[model samples]
Target chain A: MTERVRVKTMMPPGHVRTPAYLRGKVGVIERELGGFSNPEQLAYGLPAEERPLYRVRFTMEEVWGAAAETPTDTVDAEIFGHWLERL
Target chain B: MPHDHPSHSHEGMSPSGHPYRADNDTALTYWQRMEIAVRELLVEKGAVTPEEVARQIDTMDARSPANGAAVVARAWVDPDFKARLLQDASAASREMGFDIGPLRLIAVENTESVHNLIVCTLCSCYPRNLLGLPPDWYKTRAYRSRAVIEPRAVLREFGVELPDHVQVRVHDSTADMRYVVLPARPAGTEGLDEAELAALVTRDSMIGTGLPRTP
Candidate 1:
């Protein structure tokens, strides 16, 4: 079994339940906080609290097609700030 | 906007473009007002701490892909792998070393003639491991409602216009199985390596809007 998942909080422009589509794709940590379990941070589509979270970046090509038209190279996505991992 | 004429989607029938069930109009969507009440109740009862909820999200955002370069590369070259992908996407994904986290997954393959679209019927359930967070449109009421009844119209809103002949299939995502749309492999990609072809795949294409390259 994988270790218990640990999510980190990213900077404001807050957090939400990282969509299942984005989990475990090597995004950068947009924010990392000491862990907590507050449910209120889910508002504004992110963490429901001031708990630990991580904001990450992803490219449209990474998430969709490589030929995607974009003004930028990558798209930023946030995760739980963490997850159960295999050692 | 007020109008003298009746609206098309409001006749209280699925065929009339009304997306909600005949009875759903009276219900409070669980994600909005009801969920707020639930959170308040839980916090007041002290059954679950609010901090735990945020922590759960925190853990989620941490794992999103910073890049999709690699997965795209793999799908381009391996015909056997592509066939495997068409059969069972999540299983195929595992072969590529992508962590699916705790979400149930379903991959919809885009063939030459057939098309698939993804939507979240309840809140949003996206295939985060491969695609990342869903776009705001995916979660909005406009998409959730219209996608089911008028998929072609919804896709058009997203800038995908299909021909009269191409059939559209819509999948409404929920908490259970997160879905992804796999675009058909581009032609003229034969001589190119996997990585080269993967570069042509875009996020919008996977959502079933944009077409694959060299179509």
Candidate 2:
């Protein structure tokens, strides 16, 4: 089964890899892109922990709703593990 | 006594036909001053030599859309290479002798029914190792915000009007990965070799903002 996930809507003020537009949006894992250092920690010059990253695919309807240019079109983004919650 | 230093002129375009960068004679911006200070500090601390910095700049300057064009052209002619390119773009680029240096690349294919567009909504992260620097428009607020939201309209602005039957996929470089679109080869070019095909591949086509030239 394809892994389904929801992006956390946390709006913490810092250097975050997750974009504001994707927060709270639900999407499916397109592919696992292996592990990468957490940018949030790296931005503060701290020792960053490695996190698994996945490419998440969201339909235009899910991302833009009624304002979608093409309701069935898709958007893909690389989101770290911590930001994604299994759904 | 009045001293006349050699007057540096900026009247015409350079030999490359592009206007010379005005930063040399212009007042140093705050960021430029900061860069100078940081470079001097780094040199003083024995972190890096001026020659190393110059060499790195030259390396970056040598990378351009032509590198990406060659990759696309080879993919168009060789099915095995195309498969490998789609599987792992970074390795495929290196196989073709382009030094991409730590850039994790993803090659998105454009088929008859699917089109791919790339954007960096958060910032201007691009496949710079393959396509040189992102165009000024790619970094603009309009392109970044609208590319994902209204990609069809954005494509139209770039002179690409896709039919409703074709699905559009927008790749936002929000993290570590970078994407390059492998545009479909135009029809009626069977006689053309790899070099001719490469000549027809434009930077925008690889970025998915525009289509490859029809010839």
Q: Pick the candidate with the highest lDDT.
A: 2
Q: How would you encode candidate 1's per-residue C-alpha lDDT over B28-145 as one tens digit per residue?
A: 6667898889889998999889899898677657544323435545656666876777666777777777766655555567776667777765476677766677778877878765
Off by over 4 Å in 1: A1-87, B1-59, B62-69, B213-215
Native-to-model Cα distance after best TM-score fit, residue B6 in candidate 1, in Å: 45
Residue B5 displacement in candidate 1 (angstroms): 42
* DockQ category of candidate 1: incorrect
Q: Which pairs clash inside model 2?
A: none
Lowest lDDT sum, 10 consecutive residues, model 2 chain B, at B1-10
Residue lDDT tens for model 2, A1-87 = 989999999998999999989999999999999999999999999999999999999999998889888999999999999999999
| Residue B173 displacement (Å), model 1 | 2.1
Give the CA lDDT, 0 to 100, for residue A10 in model 2. 97
